[model samples]
Target chain A: MSRPALAVSALRPRTAPGWRTGLLDSLDAVGAVVLSPVELVGMAVVLLGRMAEFMLLAPFARDRFAFQRLIFARDLGDLLFGPALRVLAICVVLGIAVALVIEQFATGLLSQTGTANLVIVTSLQQIPPFVASGVLAARGALPLAVRLAEMVDRGQIDSMAIMGVDLVMLHAVPRALAVSLASVVHAVLAMVVFGVTTVLSLAGLGLVSTGTFLTALKLLPVYEKISLIGLQLLTASILVVAVALVEGIQGHGEERVDLARVSMVCILKAATVVLLVNLSFALSRMPDLPVLVWR
Target chain B: MRPAAPVDEAAANGLSVEVRGLVVRRGRRRVLDGVSLQLAAGAFLRITGPAGCGKSTLLQTLAGVLDADQGSIRLGGRPAATALAAGQVAAVFQRDSLLPELTVLENLLLPLIAGQHLSRRLAMLRAQVLLAQFGLVDIMHAWPARLSDALRRRALLARVMAVQPQLLLLDDILAGLDSAGRALIGRLLSPPDGRVASIIATSSRVDDFAHEAELLLTLPEGRISPSEPGQEGSGCDTRP
Candidate 1:
């Protein structure tokens, strides 16, 4: 007797041409790499828009905004105080290390004014925001992602949705705002610590007098200080938190392995976003990089 | 104290459910296939099947948590999603549904304040009353991690009940409870004043819900098996 057609087909080997398969794989990789940022940006826009709506409507819709206040307070307190000591330690160490390196390398190579200027600029305008982003990502964003992933895995998010709770309003907005506010606070703290440590180290090393350091600080324009704060705020509030919220909400899986993977991907993506944002800002400020700006 | 009336008292008074040719596929497997059922307002249904027989899937579908691949589900003459958005549907899953971060009292207050837009003072009052009703008054400030399995289940039910859902979908709520725990929760499930208009509960064993379920039917292989001629509360048609 002849074998059944189904069994015959099941026994048949299936293979795609090697060249075609390779081409398709390459295309898929390219598509993922190109489309991921676009998708992330779209989601971040929608999330931020919803948060703005809730905030703007709070006065007229106090009842609706009441529950979110509790969430905001809780998250804000956690984000601000949870990593305060770590951030402080990092800032103090970073400031002292940078100061010592500048004193050693630039003592005779550059004038005292130039060395002090470098110290002020690097401490206040650069480095601290990047370090703050790293700290917040590790301490704040990753944990937020893990917590949200757990909620997704456990079906608590679905349960909340079924109960008529807007997940964005209830969870995302508060967290994004908290992280943004906390990032600003941490960045400010870092800048202050770096300024203090650098000044103290330079004075102790005799590379620059306290008078010279104060003069360098006075030479730094008010606009520069404002711009630095603005840069930190924009990076943390928009980019870092957005990455965390998107990855946390969308990257959950049904297994513990999936949770770990999601956490890893969230941190990596957050770090990439922070770096790209700071790099863009740095490029825009460079006088030689006229191509980055349109007059 | 009596439970507070639902936000939409008119809609909550009665929520009739009609599900037709419902299909839910999980990957390659059809979890719910061509299942159909009709439930009148104020009725109780017990869906019994072996483990992995789509009981929870049906509940999730009915709660609007899962999308139906094919077919229709209507609650109170509206689509399931609409009814759910109106705060007319509540569900308790086999898994722990309580937010671990919130206290028992805060958990109860969540749906009220966030979902129903009730004032904090009113939500607090309603939450306290529900806690007292569920015998959870003593542990009102306790977190879900601190509660026993039975208490967690009770607290979950209490939180869902906070919104006074018109249709209650319960999946294996009595699974981990002892006999006394089961009995106490069973009494709570069928409140006297009829705050909940309808309930669809699922269990693996038929006898687990024998006392409270008004209609009992079996689901085998993603389809509802017809009730035997002499089965109790078999008046409702659940054939697929």
Candidate 2:
């Protein structure tokens, strides 16, 4: 005798949506959208706090400090030197491009002092950090993220945990510290290279003389350079690394597709963070608009 | 040859594991459903199950890698996380767990140096001894990716063994091995001196383990079934 067939939908339990359910669902979606950034910020703060603790406490604990130092040195070397040539090539090209643009726009419209001011504002102040961050994000943060995500996916992180390794001290602290220090160094290096190339390109183009550029640079105070480096340290290095590390640690699954998806997300988030941070900094520097006095 | 001595004093002794009503869920599926098991110090328990039967999940939960939705796990009269933090627990996962960036010797040295806070010289000496015992001395300097499958598995086991953990969790350590490879690992699992205190290993087939396993429990779909008559032992209460 043939058995009677049963409908697949009958086997599954179903719940009908009411007005309240739809309202609640909408609220949940809205809440997620609103709270996600807050949650991300909280994670970044906690990660940074733990890293600071490790850095502060590690030196006194001499026995564990050696391994931490080894990891730190390895990561620092990789970050600083791994993409040095690429950074140099990019900076050279950036310098030439900036110089060409400035010369084209500022030729007759501005004086030598104005051209120097423009170059100082754009080349020395603004562009270097962005370039350094972009390079480091692509070369340093992205690779670190991939490695960390792969480690998480492959159970290597769990293995480390099983062996009693402090995940923060071993992975996050060293990488974050390295990325921060390397970002500052790269930004400074880019600035110097960019400044030199811009001056030379303009000199070649006869837009401005080397002496005028030197005078302009001399007029800029040392604190400004320090502030520029500090700004890069804050935004490109610390923030970007924090986002990458958090995304990496939250990696799921061992599939190549999962890894690629995580990496793409990391890069996009990091780029967005960098842009937002720079925008905030720029806004903070802007002069207040004039307000009408009311009687 | 025997592996190295325990770097931490607490790790020298065995950990008695007591798991009660462990429940773990992955997405919509209950990977581990109210599983309960007990293992005494210096004893061996082998869990056998079919593919996707929550063997790895159980091992991971016990090792404190994955938290249970509902359950209590105590090791050596302390919590599982505490025991793990004290270097009293070591796990070799089903996948290759060695750090790809480090070499075989570095892999061995990491837990000893980082976890146990052993001196570099002492850690190096212990790592060398473990490498020698596993017959991995020649490939100690080789990267994990460069090693053959059997050798990689051996290295992973050696690295975990380097800590001389009180409780060892082996998740399908015998999965991809030939008979000889299995025999080698089996011998390591049941050393003559019994330096390792307690072990919980999972395998797809019951025969994968040697006679060293005192109790064999079959986990089908996350619940422990009655053991086969001869597979039962006093060490484990298979009363789920």
Candidate 3:
């Protein structure tokens, strides 16, 4: 039959320049960030954590994940690099900062594990959660944001709102947010596994005497761990929700044309949340500040 | 009061569309500003426009793919948004928006799947009939990536038509097709015996089916300028 002829015609339009340009721009942006030492280290930590969570631990129940054949690495690199790089930066900085926080709280936690070890643990703790947040933001928040931005770009979302599709449910905070929270939940579980392993490793190495180790473990109130998990979950949810709400309602861009604009907004949202959390923790420790009740 | 007779005339209104105060905005630009239009059952109308003048926007709004800002659009006196979403309206877009991976038959049944109203088996049966009618029976199992440009256009048209919409919106559906191909597609879209009300958007030089068309409006930079309906030409408006 003339099926082959029809298929060739279907591809006749030549995949749009926008898709190619988007991929190229993403690659260029990533190349710029990865050239710096601090940025590269940060990138490594964040990516490693994400890889471990996404590929190793198989977070989000993505055990069967395989990139579609049509979804080439070049395309993925182009699509994900710019966005993923920013995710890496936030993850790395947050990881280092958290490691510093934990080092002060519990002695010798990273004495054996050098900077690399600290990077590993901190990246482990921070990367998955951060990556989880990004995924949620991208999937749960961005689609609607993308749709709204596209609408704003095309004037369709506004019309949709005018038509009453329940802008929040039909557009903003449903699928993307739900998917993000689901991802964060997965990261939280991984954190628990990591925490147990770290605690056990310290005990096994006689780093802390068995008596002290057992006592520390015993004194580790379930309430505190639960609260910590709750905080991470809350933070991830807020970031995803905030990203969806802010970006979805704002960015005005043509759906088919402004992919770069969309990716930028995604990165901005991820970075803003990362900065907010880091700043809050940093401010909490200042010697001159009035103590907040929560702290 | 007159013997409670089943009035055959009452059932043949075909598809009626009433749109009031439809406004569409993209960013700061208002694409459609308080625009209103109507279509009687089985009426054929052509909407022509210069590029970027909201012709496609208007068609998409009618198809429920794009929501209109501040408007009331009804099909058969019910909200067209709901009805179209429920498979009462079929749409062919400017782009080949068909899923690239699915076969011809599979693509046609996407709407039924979207509505969650038709089973896979029944949808396939309907798809086969549409494909056969559109002369795409041989390519029923072929992927969209393998089809010719003409076949791709016909396949998309068939997919939308398979939904059995009371209202059909054709947005720049003939952009790439040759004259002969366009004629074939036009006949398939508004078969003479077909009862569906249709609105087609084009930028063609030829007035091919003026006899079948009730209204022909050209839009230059977003303003509708009406045209007179001409005599019958090579194309059939598809009346019985």
TM-score of each: 0.84, 0.83, 0.54
- Binned by DockQ into CAPRI classes (incorrect, acceptable, medium, high), candidate 2 is acceptable
> What lDDT does candidate 1 reach at residue B50?
79
Give the deviation of candidate 1 from the true structure as CA RMSD: 9.1
TM-score of the second chain in candidate 2: 0.85
> Judged by DockQ cut-offs, is candidate 1 incorrect, acceptable, medium or high?
acceptable
Q: Which stretches in model 1 have alpha-carbon errors above 4 Å?
A: A1-32, A251-257, A288-295, B1-13, B192-195, B221-240
Candidate 2 lDDT (Cα, 0 to 1): 0.70
Which model is ahead, 2 or 3, in terms of lDDT?
2
Per-residue lDDT tens digits of candidate 2, residues A1-295? 1111110100111235779777877897799678867766876686678678768988887665666677788888998998778778988998888778877777786553354444454446666777777777776568777777777666767766667675534666677778778878887888888888877887788888777776656544434557745765565667777777766766343233267877898899888877777666655543321110010
Q: What is the clash count of model 2? A: 0
Give the number of the best model, judged by DockQ. 2
lDDT digits (tens) for residues B9-40 of candidate 2? 35345777777677876645666766666566
Looking at model 1, the pairs that clash are: none
* lDDT tens digits, residue span A191-211, model 3: 454444444454444343334
Clashes of each: 0, 0, 20
Candidate 2 regions exceeding 4 Å error are A1-33, A54-62, A112-117, A120-122, A251-257, A282-295, B1-13, B77-82, B221-240
Error of 1 at A16 (Å): 16
Q: Of the pair 2 and 3, which is ahead by TM-score?
A: 2
lDDT per residue for candidate 1 within B80-130, as digits (tens), equals 767766777777767646887788888898878777778888999999889
